[model samples]
Target: MQTGISYCFLLGWLLCSCSETKSNHNQSIQDTAAVLLQQDSTSVFTTTALVEDTTVRFDMSEVPSEPDTKIKILEIGNFHNNEVWKGADNKQWYGLFQTTTGYYVKKTIVQVKTVYDALLDTKYVWSGKQVSVSDKDTCLLLITGISLPERNIDTVVMSQKTIWPSEKISFTVDSITYTLRATGKRQKISNEVSDYRLYISIIKDGVEKQQLLVVHDVFDDTMTVVMWVGDLDGDYKPDAIIDVSNHYNNHRPALFLSGEASEKEIMKKVAEFSQLGC
Candidate 1:
């Protein structure tokens, strides 16, 4: 009877030990699954945070999708009656002209398209050569090619009177008065050649601001003349047309548009005028 009792006790002990081990294994598995689920949740949260940060850093609406449509104004002028000094090689060299009262200033308004076309225009070619000069005497050695002629101003009526470099030219655009004045300082190019530059000032609401307008460099004997300033596009804006000529020859007119219209709009107007052969 004792032996049978001992056998029953051993069997019960084995069964209890097996059950406890199985319970511990199931608890371990549950803990591992919980840890994996927490890691996955953390990964998803981190990804979401990164996306939100990127969205906050960049705003798509702030970037422009189109080209610049603002109006661009370019002024053209000439430097004339420049004195030529002979070099040691007996070749004539041009001296930098330094006079505010003897040059010409012209303003031209063009669109981005016109500028592109002008850059690609093959009619006018610019070439220059450097002349050898002695160290004692400073002279300009580079000489550019002639200015290309425009058909529109070839027969247009020009001013018979001479416009001095110091003359203050004024025009009204959109009821705002703009005055152009030449500073008379020589615009130096590499300390050899120089041209005349003009300043455009406007008074709006009793505030005045001066802007620089660069014109052509005048190397030949020429005269400054104001061609015309009026409305050309019926946009109620005053358009200024100026030119530099030599004894009724080599007439070059520069057209300027000053108004509320954008550069793109001005380019369209120029294109239309070109189609009309004007």
Candidate 2:
């Protein structure tokens, strides 16, 4: 809720650079998890504890007081002379800055959570940053950012047209909880409105990128789900897998699209809930 932090000219350039230059536009950006680590005298990562669900942990105080690492904002543009300020809810703080292409300063709120790694079976807190995009003219813009851990790149950036379904939604195949909020509307295929939720999780492996998405549909009453494991990030080779559901109670098969090696694998049950019936 603070104002006059700096001149708005800087925001103008960020927009033009992303639009005017096609090559400059980063389309593969996705959501990921991050961890804010501080180097102690022992030169190791020691967790910075704060209040429960408090954004104060990420306060700019840590930014200026300690050695700041270059944390990337997936599915969003990089910041310029950005400063983190505490939100009205003193419990948290946000990264604020003027964009080169806009008249308003961007505000990014973030949180951290530790999740169990299925592969390693260990717990790791993933940083999640939410960015709200606004302009002087538009009082309410739908654009927001979610920063995932480096391993999980490719953040999602969408307007109100694509607010993901949070109910029954999840990031991983085994997740019992939903990560996004969804409307009850069904897609007719003709409509750009997607009732399904797409989750892309990536981890950096040397120079190559590993991308995986848990795209599923839970709108229908039937048991329908799709699991895709491939390079949805478009890195030339096809390294993904897709699974479509096959329902029992008179439901149709679903479609699960994945990989680029050849045919797009379609899940039988997934088709059951497809827009074909909607």
Candidate 3:
């Protein structure tokens, strides 16, 4: 009888210990859950606060004109994998680099009002030279900057617009009296190639200045086209001198003279004139 009683007591003690162990394990799980919930709540609140502050700051920064205005290019830099720009979507391209002013500056091949803002917290790698085509066809700019691995990426593509002016002039084919006039603001042509478009002023008596035939005979790809008003051949009258050379060649310096002078005098005087750099 004593042995049976001792066995019963031991079984009861074992059951009690197991129950306590299970309760302790459950409590530990609950404690961990509470800590995780608290951390999540704090994180959410902090993010919300940051978002609200950023919205307000953006509104405050709105102004008529940007304080630090710059020009943006549609296309810049060389391309990786030797792939060229396919000209699918005509977006301006820009390449940002650290400038001497501590702020980043960009050089664009396209003509734009200002440079696009540099990306924040993004590190651009200039491991290889990349080439980009400007959105504007008149200005073919080549930029040397960071390379992007993907195409049509919002972070890589620019939204800025590039404006280009025409470098082609309309001249008459007849050698009659006429007046030259500038139609609009002169636009910048590609600096890589020196070819500018200028309106000619033809002043003829008893002749409709607009009706006279003006033919443009000098359009050079390698020469710099320049215009000046001066007197030629000891004549006190003002004559137009369009120097068609880059001051390097000595033979047949192309000249365009518009006045009452004969074609022979235009050729002789211009050939004798010295060359000047553009």
Candidate 4:
């Protein structure tokens, strides 16, 4: 929870050169999984481990972590500079400074489980070292980690799919029923472009558990895709990472971890990464 550790990020944490750029609309489920590895003695990225293919076949259950890996980074989030000091509850964080000089300085990293069989989204909290980096320009950090899985888990992931209005898909996990539904309306926003509003939600036993997404006034041609589906927090309940971007010219993906949800909610959105296309 210190303010000086970005080393916890997976080997290749994608640093943005500029904000709001075009994003990959067709990214696969594997792209959402961040595999964090531990560096060996006296070096950076000097370790290697064996990993199995995780293309996510329908017959697959759980994805395997590389044997030599350290913490399996689920999702890293930014709470803006002002929100860094307060932090989120029941969550962990690894912080780093985005210095005025436009570079990163490594500080601290806490070791978690070496092997991860499940992927979960997380919230965060930064501890100290706010002044260690200089006057500062940006505040950033990572999220929760647990020692090891209590038991082996089966694969509960589904491939990415574009969901249209009136189109719903159902699947079973942990003996619980789940349905992904999409509903929306279209309106003209401009002479050349139309506006749209889409409501994406989860249904269980004739009840709507949560309104996962409600994209409003999105540009024409925008579509929502259920990027990946499964238990993102290993809570046995379903969690998701979804793309509710304006498909033709934008990419806005959000990560939801079931473990962070409130009692009445099925999942809580802990992180969202976005970009805009010209």
Q: Which has the greatest lDDT?
A: 4
RMSD of each: 21.9, 35.6, 20.8, 34.6
Worst 10 residues of 4 by lDDT: 121-130
Instruction: For model 3, give the 10-residue run with minimal summed lDDT.
Output: 152-161
Per-candidate local distance difference test: 0.39, 0.28, 0.33, 0.44
Ranking of candidates on lDDT, top first: 4, 1, 3, 2
Best by TM-score: 4
Each candidate's clash count: 3, 55, 27, 5
Give the TM-score comparing model 1 with the true structure, all chains together: 0.31
> Which one wins by TM-score: 2 or 3?
3
Ordered by TM-score, highest first, the candidates read 4, 1, 3, 2
Q: What tens digits encode model 1's per-residue C-alpha lDDT throughout 1-278?
A: 99999999999999999999999999999999999999999998988783322221211222222212232212122111111111212312222111223212222221111111122223332111112322222221111111212212112122343334565666666677767666343334532212565556777789776655435456344554555554443445444445543323454444444443353332121100000001
Per-residue CA lDDT of model 2 for 173-215, tens digit only, reads 2221123333444545633333454443222233322222334
For residue 240, give model 3's deviation from the true position in Å: 3.8
lDDT of 1 at 187: 31
Query: Candidate 3 on 66-185: residue-level lDDT in tens?
Result: 112122122233222112222312333443332233222233443222122232111221222233333332222222222222221111111221111243232332343322332223
Model 4: per-residue Cα lDDT over 13-118, one tens digit each:
5444222233443243335432222222324433454565654322112223222222222223321222222222223433333444432323334322212112
Candidate 1 at residue 192, lDDT? Answer: 21
2 against 3, candidate with superior lDDT: 3
